[model samples]
Target: MNEGIIEGFNRAQITDETLVKMRESSARDVDNLPIIRENSAALYRFLITALKPLCALETGTCRGYSAILAAKTAASYTDSFKCYTVELDSVNAQEAIKNIAAEGLTEHIKVIHGDAAEVLASLSGQFDIIFLDSSKSHYSEMLPDVKRLLRRGGVLIADDIAYYGKTEAGEVPHKHRTIVNSLRAFIRQISEDEDFTAVIDTMDDGMLLAVKN
Candidate 1:
């Protein structure tokens, strides 16, 4: 297989100097943390900038890489844009807060420390974008709340859905069967729902980007 051509064609639509730093910083913990893929991060910056969302929500706050990128992009459009990200682990949340501050996005990005379900339930404002990058097993469970919080025409982006490039509904590793099944179900629900227009972007790790009707 010619992987070179594949890489050449998956070009990024936008670029930012901070992205390289964030990518390098997060790469340090790639073994333990699920940091955003290079291509994924580029695409995220592109989409968020294009969307210019006034308010956004993200489920994962791993070291605040993606959250900071999102805040940077949103802030470029308007100073009032706000980003609220949820982190289930207290330690990760604390680290994310520090990183957000270091990036000088403390005013634009807010890290909420708690379970995604609980944090999402308490959220009061409708968002122009929602990002799902937390527990794979809970993506399905969190879809209802995501839908409730996402405004019409808003974007819902989920990462790592096509785990290890395996998205088909069938056999999976014993330990990962539940997560795979849940992801498959979530895909089906979003794809079949009349209110959404969704597609799976096979860039690097699989990304599911859907727009609410």
Candidate 2:
């Protein structure tokens, strides 16, 4: 995938060396971890810089890779905004806390450990951007909270919506049939909802980008 550039501003905040090191070191320790893909991460980073969100929320914080990118984007502007991320696994959350701190982003990025649904419900105040990377099946289940928590005109981005194109073709693996059905519902809901304007980018895995009315 070609490295993306955000014209004019010189995205020197996240250096190429940093991304390469992360993609290398992260995969070594994590078995089956769904770290954000190169182009996907670049696209999201571009969104953060473009949107200039004052506050951001992320459902899944896998070792803090995406969280770091978010925090860096937040830091690139001002310290007033913060990035809140949650991870269901205690191990991943703890590792994220350590890694974020190592990068001196502990203040900008806070890692919460628990089921995303419960954690999101407990959160107070709205956010300018929301990122979902948890179980695809849980998306529609969480849309109520997501809609309520997202500020007017806020952005919501969800990953892996295509399920390897199974969602469109209706040929789902037995083990992943439930997820495919749920994702299909999720995609349909966002696209048809009156309060939101959405589009699906056919990246490696699909990405649903929506803006609330």
Candidate 3:
């Protein structure tokens, strides 16, 4: 990956030394996987600066890397900013809570353990930013809830939009064909729906940044 392209995608204005330290320390503890390999700390930080969301929602809490980054960025912009993260795996959820706390972000984040869909259903207040990072197959099913939860003019940032069997057109392999089809449907909804307008960027897997219209 070219440095310019990566930095541009992240909307990085000035390179921060602390971000590098966080990444280095984070890599030492986290097991590298395909989904986890594409860390979006920079993107999260950019969003926090750009939107200054008072309340943010994340669908997945993996080791608390992104959540911590969001919280750190949020701390500078809003006095009451907080991130509510949902994790399906009990072990990951508990570990994520501890990890966020270890990063001194306990005051800015809350981890909810359970199915993200079920958790979203119980959420009362609207969020200014919604990050979709859970099971790729469930992304389509999460569309309605994401739309409902996001406030007017809010942004929805979805990662891994074009990967594995997921393509610009939502094509996928036979074994995971359903997920592919669902991804296509979800992408179409985001693109065609007048309620939202999206810009798709091919970086760190495909990233779709959609703002409510």
Candidate 4:
């Protein structure tokens, strides 16, 4: 976590010290992988605390940081909360399982190793909250299943929509153009869709939040 964001979270009293320390430790453990940004994590914490979701789903489980955070936060409000997180890489999935176990949240957070789209397609039951943090290019492709699996009043959060600012940049580099275009399309689809009330939070890289109506 960034020192500045940590300070802001402390001042706002959005998260407890324990979770903050866990985020810091997870960062050190997975220094090479991209974990959830501090600002984004705070946003997620706030939403989970407010929603008190009984069932949650996450598309990316780099080291189970976000899943653990959500599960712990939801545990405060409900005893029946369960979170299912998917990771495509087997190595990351194993690391996520280990991390969740270290947090003593193995019972609440389930780590599945498989392609996100395939897993989402196979999943049944509606989720109260759905977090999409997988490949930016596949977001649009996965929206259908995401919508189907989210309950009518569920919240859908898509992280890294800005893709290091390239999605909204006036001139995107050639290498990033494909993902930028894909993210923009995903944003447009969610923003224009009548079923959802959507907005983009320009914090961290950027997060697209939508509520299914």
Candidate 5:
């Protein structure tokens, strides 16, 4: 596709009305965290619409809100969408399962409970899209596994990349410094790696879109 065509395609997919509503709905119902800000709903919808991915994986399945949004968006193009979501907390996992079922999307979403790293290790299939929204401090450690799991041409979305000032120089806050260091290293690794081309956007806090080669 030409530049205009690609840009238009991205715009059309990003602006779906139903998808926008789903994102807005997520913010209202789920625990309002800065990381899971409202913009992610739209961003996720845009990604699904553009990629039309059949298989998607999310590292964090908090309340199942974002997973539901992703599944709903992916289903628009494919007859079915499989969203494998991992949550470390059982309570959150149970709630997500109920919410997903309540959304009438039990078939499209699969909820897994365990440490994300261990859970990811056991998975076999390559993903068309992967969203990293788990522990920020572990972002760097997760990159190798994430790379293995994502298929070439697949998209990897990272949230809160620019927030927490993790990449900023010097005088880091004690609480967020570790996460900051990890994100900085993680971003640098993706940027320098020959296997991926990435674009970091400041839409909400920060969002990074990396496409595997």
Candidate 6:
């Protein structure tokens, strides 16, 4: 976590004390599932503030940190805000529910327990913002549903697109080849798609931000 970036955003400008504490607490998770990095979380909070999205969808709700952040931030701007976050792991999903409750955002954020792709397929309404941060290999496979669920002019944010720099560096190790290749394919697919105007942010791993045209 960069103190300079935090100071630049200004804690008061981005989020409240409780959420900040939550972020810090979640940083020490025992299972070591990747939580959103500070810079990436800041970017998310900034986007939610800027966009004021009423309905946001998030995949990969690991302990509900990002979803809670989004819900709380959006709540500052609009009463209509609601976030639906999906998690595949039952234990993670339960933890997310508890964390959301702890944040007093249970009404604003829903933690759905299921496979991300299947859950996306079952969801019916359009989302103003859709975030993809689930399994790396599943990203490309989930694109069709993501495209379908996001409304026109909605924002799509995909995290960990660089696979910790493995996607860009030469000679990906054998074990990482699948994820690296999938992330590269996902990047290419979004970049070449006619309907989206996209850009990659290389801070804290990598994030792909695209607007549906």
Q: Global lDDT of each model?
A: 0.84, 0.84, 0.76, 0.86, 0.80, 0.87
**Residues 70-173, model 2: lDDT tens digits:** 77776778777788998999999998898888888888888888999998888779999999998889998899899999999999999878878888875777
lDDT of 6 by residue, 74-144 (tens): 87788768999999999999988998898788899998899999999888889999999899898998898
lDDT of 4 by residue, 9-95 (tens): 543654556566656666656565577887887888889998889999999898787888888788888877899999999888998
**Most accurate candidate by lDDT:** 6
Q: After superposition, how far is residue 83 of candidate 5 from its true place, in Å?
A: 0.4
Per-residue lDDT over 1-213 for candidate 5, one digit per residue giving the tens place of the 0 to 100 score:
344654455445545454444445555457443236655556778778888999999988877767877877777788688999999989889978987887788999999998888888788889999998888777788889999999999999988888655565676788877788888899899989999999987756688899999
Query: Which is superior by lDDT, 1 or 5?
Result: 1
Compute each candidate's TM-score over C-alphas. 0.90, 0.89, 0.85, 0.90, 0.84, 0.91
Q: What residue pairs clash in candidate 5, if any at all? A: 166-180
Whole-model lDDT, model 1: 0.84
Best by TM-score: 6
| TM-score, cand. 6 vs. native | 0.91
Number of clashing pairs per prediction, in order = 0, 0, 0, 0, 1, 0
What residue runs in model 4 are displaced by over 4 Å at the alpha carbon? 1-7, 10-18, 25-30
Worst 10 residues of 2 by lDDT: 5-14
User: Candidate 5 lDDT (Cα, whole model)?
Assistant: 0.80
Assess the local accuracy of residue 154 in candidate 5 as a C-alpha lDDT between 0 and 100: 98
Clashing pairs in 3: none
